[model samples]
Target: MVRRVMVDEEGVEMRVRINDMKEMVKEAVGNSGSSQESLEGLVKFILSR
Candidate 1:
């Protein structure tokens, strides 16, 4: 997951972006990342059986 979703933005804008962190984390856990990809693969393996 990205550490900073935005850089050099207004506080309001940054705060607004911060609100999406939950969704971002969900996506990351959904295998939208390398680390999560490995975990997801494991989950798939189990589900495949």
Candidate 2:
């Protein structure tokens, strides 16, 4: 696992790391997520061209 730090320079600070695959997948499939929507748009544009 990789180590990371999340610092709220104006408030608080904490150590965190993204070690959850399921959480990542859930976010990647969210209804209006940028990554998913952008990918779909890209495919559609390619097909239309």
How much lDDT does each candidate structure score? Answer: 0.72, 0.62
RMSD for all candidates, in order, please: 8.1, 7.1
* Model 2 spans > 4 angstroms off: 1-31
User: After superposition, which runs of candidate 1 have C-alpha atoms over 4 Å from their true positions?
Assistant: 1-9, 30-37, 42-49
Q: List the candidates' TM-scores in order.
A: 0.35, 0.41
Q: Of the candidates shown, which would achieve the greatest lDDT relative to the real structure? A: 1
- Residue-level lDDT tens digits of model 2 in 1-49: 1232333542223222234655677788887776789899999999999
| Top candidate by TM-score | 2
- Tens digits of lDDT, candidate 1, 1-49: 1334444346557777777986787777775676698888899999999
Give the least accurate 10-residue stretch of model 2, judged by summed lDDT.
9-18
Residue 47 of model 2, lDDT score: 100
